[model samples]
Target: MEILRVKEILNEKGWRNKDLADKIGTSENSVSAIVTGKKFPKPETLVKIADVLDIDIRELFNPSKSVDLQEIFTKDENGNLKSVGFIKK
Candidate 1:
């Protein structure tokens, strides 16, 4: 889905996962997992990714599925999106 788009963006920018991770202050593995769809980025981190890649967040939405952008990014009472089941190391 959007993983393809991310890869395309990276290629277009002559960058790689490590480059993206470095630019956004995240681990390369995190970015790799994200690109491979093995994990999802935190909503805030996703925003950073969109900014780094110079794309709209909507562009990252997977078109093949029923992606509820609002629900996925909805803030909790603590003002943080609920965990997407992975943790930052």
Candidate 2:
């Protein structure tokens, strides 16, 4: 799930990960992890990131309609692919 739009916003602002990291007093690796969704940021960190980017925190998330459930899938016992939205009764 490509939730965060940090990387895109960074590109738009002509800023690098290190630039944001320095502004927020964190390591570039930490920012990269957040940008890549490898690390879920703490609320404070998220606020700092939003502040640095001059965007509302809500802008960091993808709209619900924009999230593709098919992208989040897993295999079943029979090796059948199952989307996260699949329901079994």
RMSD of each: 12.9, 12.1
How high is each candidate's TM-score? 0.62, 0.70
Clashing pairs in 2: none
Which runs of model 1 end up more than 4 angstroms from their true locations? Answer: 1-4, 65-89
Q: 24-48, model 1: which lDDT tens digit per residue?
A: 9989999888888788788899899
- Lowest lDDT 10-residue stretch of candidate 2: 63-72
Report the CA-based lDDT of candidate 2 relative to the real structure.
0.88
> Candidate 2, which segments miss by more than 4 Å at Cα?
66-89
Going through the candidates in the order shown, the clash numbers are 0, 0
lDDT of each: 0.78, 0.88
User: Candidate 2: lDDT of 88?
Assistant: 33
RMSD of 1: 12.9
lDDT of 2 by residue, 1-89 (tens): 68889988999999999999999999999999988889989999989999989999999887767433334578999999887764333
Task: In angstroms, give how far residue 41 of model 2 lies from its true place.
Answer: 0.4
- As a whole number from 0 to 100, the lDDT of residue 68 in candidate 1 is 39
